[model samples]
Target: MSKKGFAGFDPEGLERAAEAVRELSQSPHAQSVIQLQIRQQEAKSEEAKALQKERELKKITHDHEERRKTLQKNLEINKETADYNDKLERKRHTDKLKLQDEFQEQQRKKQEESIKREEKLKRETMEHQLKIEEKRLLIKGKVDAEMYRKNHDLHKQELLMREAERRETYKQIFQLNFNQLSLGFEYLMNNPSFMYKFFLYTASITTAFYFSRHSIQLGKNILFLRIETNLQKKLYIFLGSRYLESVIGKPSLIRETSKLSYKQFYKFPLKFYKQVTQNEQILKKNIFQNIILAPELKDNLQIISHALINKKKHQAPLRNLLFYGPPGTGKTLFAQQLAHSSGLDFAIMTGSDIAPLGSQGVHELNKVFDWANKSSNGILLFIDEADAFFRKRENWNSIEKSYGRSRYKLT
Candidate 1:
C-alpha cells in the first residue's frame, strides 16, 4: 500500500498518468508508452517487492506442512536418516539465502535503471505537455516538482525566523532588567526612604542609614544606625552581589554592595544586645553563593558584581531610622545592629520611656544630640513598639494591629 505523500493529490497523479498511458495506447507510441508506465510505477515498487516475498515464503513453506506439528516423529528414529535430513535442510536454507540476496541485488539494479529511464521519459513527457498546450490548453495538475520543493524550503525558513525572534525577545528582557537595577541603586542613595518603604526586608540594624554630618566635622559622612534595646539577639547581614549573567547571578563579578554602618555593633545593655553578622565566609565555600541574611535586621544590602571578571564595591550609611515592621519579624533587634554596623554613639528612647519624661526630655533632646555630636558622626535611637505612644490610648489595646500597621507601612 502507498502512504499518502502529497496529502490529497499523489494518488490522483498516479491515476492521470495511468490515463496518459491509455491515451498513448490509442496512438502508434503504445508499446513505448507501456514501457514508460512500468518506469513510473517505481513509487510502489517496495509494496510489489513485499508481496512477491510473501508469495516466495509461502511456496518455500508449502512442503513443511503445519508449523505446530510435534517433534515426536515416527523417525525420532534412525540417526543416519536424521543426520542426512539435517544436512539437506541446511543446504536448502543456504540456497534460499543466496536466492534472496540475488533477488534483492536484481531489484536494486532494476530500480536504478528505472530512475534513469524516468529521467529520459520525463524530458519526452515535458515535450508532449508543450505540444498539447500548443494545440489547446492542458489543465495544470495539482502536484508540481518545483512548487513542492519551494514550499518545503519556505517552511524551513519560517521556523528559523521564529527562533530568531524568540532569542531577540529574551535579550531585550535582560537589557531592561539591567537598567532597572541601575535606577534602583541610584534612587536608594538619593531617597533611602523609598527603599525602606517599598523593597524593605529583614536585615541588620547597621544596614539602615542616610548621609550623616557632625556639627564641627563637615565633610565626613556619619552613617546612622538604630539600636535594639534588648540584649543577646543575633543579627546577620546579607551583602548579595548578584551578577546579571542570568536570572541567578554569580557573586564573584560583583562590583559593589551596600549595607548599614557597624557603629552600633557594641552599644546597648547586655540585656538588650543582639549579635550582628554577615556570613560571607560560608557562602564562599558553596558552589552557588547567594548571600542571604538571618531574619530580624531592618534592611538588606545591594550587591552589584560582574561574574566574568572579579570586581567589588561596598557602601552603606551608619545613621538614624524609625523602627517599624510586623510584631514578630524582629523590628527592635535590627535597630541595634544599625548602631553596631556604624560604630556610632547610641541612645534608646521608646514611646513610653519618653512619654513620662516629655517636656523635661525635650530639653534633654538638645543635650542628647550635643553628646552624640561630640562623640560619633551618627546616633541610633530605638523607639521599638512605639505604636502604643502614637496610637490613641483607648485604641491602643482595643485597636487591631492592622490599624497600627496601616499607619506604619515600613515594608
Candidate 2:
C-alpha cells in the first residue's frame, strides 16, 4: 500500500476509481455531480474569509483601549503635582507676610519708647532750671533786705543830728534881745506922722537905688568894661589890665583832682611864671616825669607832641583835642604836659564859668579863641568839665537836640 496516496486511496483503488469516473463521464449524471462539488467548495472558502476578518477587528479594539487607559493615568499624575506646587507657594507667601507684620509691630513699640524718654528728660530739665531760678531770687531778696536795713540806720542818725542842730538854732534865736526891736515897731505903727515920714524916706531911697543901678550900667557900657556885674568888674580891675595874664596863670589850676576848687586859679601865677622861665629841656623833662600814664598813652603823647610841634613850626591852623575821663584820671595834667612839650601855650578854662554866663557863654568862648589865635606859638585851650555844656538839655525838642548836638561838637 502506498500510504493511501493523496486522497486516501491505493494505486489499484485509485485506478479503479478513475475507471469508474471515466465510465461515469460517459453518462449525463456524472457531469452534474462534478459541477455541484465545485459549488460547495466555493461556499466553504467564503465562510473561512469572514471568520478571519472578525478576529482582526477584535485585536485592533483591544490595543486602542489599552492606549487610552495609559493616557488617562498620566493626566491624573500631572494634576496632583500642580496642586502640591500651589500649596507650597501659598504657604511661603503666608510666612513672608507674617514676618513683615511682626517687624512693624517691633518698630512701633521702639518709637513709642523713644518719645516717652524725650518727654521725661524735658520735664526734668525744666524742673531743674526752675529750682535754680528760685534760689537766685531768694539770695537777691536777702541782699536787698540787708541794704535796706543799713540805709534805714544811717537815715535815722542823720535825722537825729539835724534835730539837734535845729534845737540849738532855736535856743540861740530865743536868747537874742528882741524887746527893743518890738517896742520900736509898736511905736512906728502907733505914730501916723512918723510912719508917713518913714514911708517917704523909703520911697526916696528906692528911687535913688534904681537910678544908681541904671547909671552904673550905663557907665559900664560907655567905658567898654564888658563886665556883666559889679562884682565881676571889681574882680576884673583887681586882677589887672591884661585880662588873661595876671591872675589867670598856669599852676593855679592844680589841686587834688577829685576835689577841684573853683578858687585854685588865684594862687598859680608866680609859681607858673617861675617854671616857664626854666630851661626848655628841664621843663619838658619835668612834665614828662610828673605824668603817670600807660606806656601806650605815653607813646601817643609823644606822637601828638611831634605833630603839634611840626604844625606850629609850619604856622598851620591848630587842631582841637578832647580829653575825657572820670575825675582824678590826670586829664588836666596830661593837657598841661602836652602843651609844654609841644611848645604851645596852655590856656585852661572851667566849663562851670561858662555855664553861669547863660547867653554870654558863646561870646566868652569866642573871646578865648581870639586870644588863643593871637599867640605866636599855637595854644592848647583845655576846657575841663566840657560835659557841662555838651550835655543834652531836657527841655530841647528834636530839632533843637539835633542842632545843639552839632553845635556842641565845636566846643
Candidate 3:
C-alpha cells in the first residue's frame, strides 16, 4: 500500500508504465490523438504569433508612413523656403542693379555738366584772349604811328633849322653889302627915277601875292560849297525826301540857311541808311491777296490798317507793336508794308550793331532819337534782333554781360 501510493515506486511497475506510455504513444489512435492535440496547440501558438507579428507589422507600417509623410512635408517646406529665398535674392539683385543704374545715370549727368562747364570756360577764355590780342595790336599800331609821326616832325624841324641857318647867312652877307652901299643909297635917294622904279616893283609883287591868295581861297570855298550841296542831295535821297523836308526845311531853304561850317554839320559816327529795293512781286499788292496768313492775323491786320488810316483824325497816339514768332515769319516785311501803306519813312537798325559800342551807344541812340524827333512827318523805327540788347535782365548769361551794359547805356 505504501508502494502503491507513489505511482513509480516499484522499478518494474515504473518500467511497465513507461513501456505502456511509450506503446500508447506509438499506437495509431493514441499517436493520432496526440498529434491532433499537438497540432491544435501548435496552431493556437502559431495563430497568436501571427497576430502579434501582424500587429507589429501594422505598427511598423504606420510608423514608416508617418515618417514618409513627415519627410514629404519637410521636403515641401524646404522647397518653399528655397523658392522664397531665391525670390528674395532675385529682388535684391534687381534692386542692386537699379541702384547701380541710377548711380551711373547720375554720374553720366554730372560728367556731362562738367564737360559743358569746361567747354564754356574754354570758349570764354579764348574770347578773352582774342580780345586782349586785338587790344594789344591796336595799341601797338597806335604807338608805331606815333613814333613815325614824331620822327617825321623831327626831320621837318631839322630841315627848317638848316633853311633858317642858310637864310641867316644870306641876311648877314646882305647886311654887309648894304653897309657898303649906304653911301650909294644916299646918292640914289637924290635920284627920283631910281626911287620910283623900286617902289613900283615892290607894289606889283604885293598885289600879285594878295590876288593869288584871294583866288585860291575863293576856289576852295566854291569846291566846299559844291561838296556840301552834293552831300545834302544824297542825304535827302537816302532818308526820304519828306523826312528831310519836314525836319531840315525845304531843299532851297536848306541850301540858303546852311551857313554853318562843314565841320559843324558833318559830325562823326554817322549812321547811314540802307536802300531797300522794292519787291516788284509784292509791292502795290493787297495785304491779304499776296501773302498767306492766319484768319486771326488777317483780322488783326485789317483792324490795324483801319486804325492807322484814321489815325490823323483822332488825338490818341499810335499804339506800339511787338511782333513775336519764329524766324523767317516776315516781321520785317510786315513792318515795311505797314510803313509803305501809312506813308511813313521806315528806318531799319540792328540791335547787334549797338551792343558793341558800350557807353558810346548811348550817345548814338540819343542822336538817333534826336534826329527822329526833328521829323515833323512820322518815322517808323524798326529794330531787328531786338532781343540781342533788350533781353530780360533776369535771364542774362555770362556772354550777355557786355550786351547788358550796352542796354543800360541805352536806357
Candidate 4:
C-alpha cells in the first residue's frame, strides 16, 4: 500500500482496512461470525413481533370481558322490570275478580228482595179478592132470601084468595039451604027434646074446641108442633130490652137463642156454615192465614184441629177445652178459630149475664147445653169470663142476694 496524505480520507487507515478485509475474506472463521450475527438479528426481530401479538391478544380479552359484564347487567335489569310488570298485572286481575264478585252479590240480593215484595203483594191481592168474593156471595144470598120470601108471600096470597072463594060458595049454598029449612028450624026450636039435643051438641063442640086450644098451646110451649116461632120477638117483648138482629152470611135453618152482650153467635154460625158450604181448603187457608202464633203453639193447634175434624167426621163425642188466660190474650179468638176449624157450630155467652140472671141461670145453662146436644154437627159453647159464673155453692147464695138487690134497685 502507498502512503498518501490528502484524499479527503484517512489514507493510512484505509490502506490498513483494505489489507485486513483481504485477509479476513480469505478466512472461513470470518464467514461463520457473519452468519451467526445475521441469525441473532432475525431471532430478535421474531421475538419482538411475538411480544406485540401477545399484548394485542390480552387487550382483546379484557374488552370481551367488559362487554360480557355490561350484557349481563342489562339482562338483569330487563328481567326485574318484566317481573314488576307481571306482579302489577296479577294484582289488577285479582282486583277485577273481586269487583265482579261484589257486583254479582249485590244483584243477587236485589233479586231476592224483589221476589219477597212480589210475594207479599200477591198475598195481599189474594186476600182482597177473597174478601170481595165473600161480600158478593153475602149480597147474593140476601137477594135470594128476599126473592124467596116475596114468592112465598105471593103464593100465600093466592091460596088465601082461593080459600075465600071456596068459603063464599059454601056460604051461598048454606044460605039457600037455611032459607028452605027456616020453617022446620022454628018448629024444632019449639020442641023441647030437639032443643035439648041441639044444646048438647053445641056444648060438646065447645068443650072439644077448648081442649084442642089448650093442647095446641101446650104443644107450642114444649116445641112439639115443629112450628117456626118468632123467639126473638117474643124475647124482646118479654124482656123489654133492645134485641138487635143482624143477618149474617147465610140463613140458619134452626132458630138459635138470643145472645146477651156480643152476638158472636150469628158470626160463628156464619163461619161454620161457610165451612160446610164453601170449599173446605179455602176456608181453612183463610182461617190459618189470619192467625199468627208461635211455631210450637201453631203445631199443637193444628194437631187439635185435625183431631177435632176427625171426631166430627166420625160423629164421635168431642172433648171440651178450657182456655185460661188474661184478658185480650186471644182466648176468644182461638176458640172461634178452633170451632171453625173443627166445623162445629159455636155459641158465645157471657158469665156476667148469668150472675144477673140469679134463679134463671141454671135454667139458661141447661137450655144452652140442651141446644148444643140437639146440634147435628156439635156445638162449641164459648163462655167468656167463666170465673164469674163458676164458684163454690156457698158463693151462689151471695150472688143471688146481689142479683136480688140489683133487681130491687132497678125496679
- Best of the candidates, lDDT: 4
Off by over 4 Å in 4: 1-277, 314-316, 401-411
TM-score, candidate 1, is 0.21
Per-residue lDDT of model 2, residues 1-411, tens digit only: 455666765688778899988998898888788888778777777777777777777777877887787788877888888888889889989998899989998988899898889889989999999999999999999998898787998889899998898677556544432543466578989998998997787566555544543455465455555445577666564444344332222233322221112234232333354344444554444565666788997788766666675674677655677876799988888877777666666777776555555666676676566556655555677888877677676633443555567769977
Poorest 10 consecutive residues of model 2 by lDDT?
253-262
Q: Write the per-residue lDDT of candidate 4 for residues 1-411, one digit (tens) a residue.
A: 556566655478777789988887898798887788788998988998888889888888988998899999999999999999999999999999999999999999999999999999999999999999999999999999999887997889999998898677668756655664676578777898987886687566555544543454464456533356577755544332111111211112223332211223324434443344454554454456666777997788777776777784676666777777688867777777667666676777777678776677786676566555656666777888888878998898888788789889999
Ranking by lDDT: 4, 3, 2, 1
Which residue runs of candidate 3 sit more than 4 Å off their true CA positions? 1-285, 392-411
Which scores better on TM-score, 3 or 4? 4
Better of 1 and 3 by lDDT: 3
How far residue 372's Cα lies from its native spot in candidate 4, in Å, is 1.6
For candidate 4, the TM-score is: 0.33
After superposition, candidate 2 runs with Cα above 4 Å error: 1-277, 314-317, 393-411
Off by over 4 Å in 1: 1-320, 388-411
Residue-level lDDT of model 3, residues 294-405, one tens digit each, is: 8999789778865664577675567778778788877877777766665565667777776566557666676556655665557667777777668664654543576677
- How do all models score by TM-score? 0.21, 0.31, 0.30, 0.33
What tens digits encode model 1's per-residue C-alpha lDDT throughout 217-266? 22111211335422322121111111111112211211121212233322
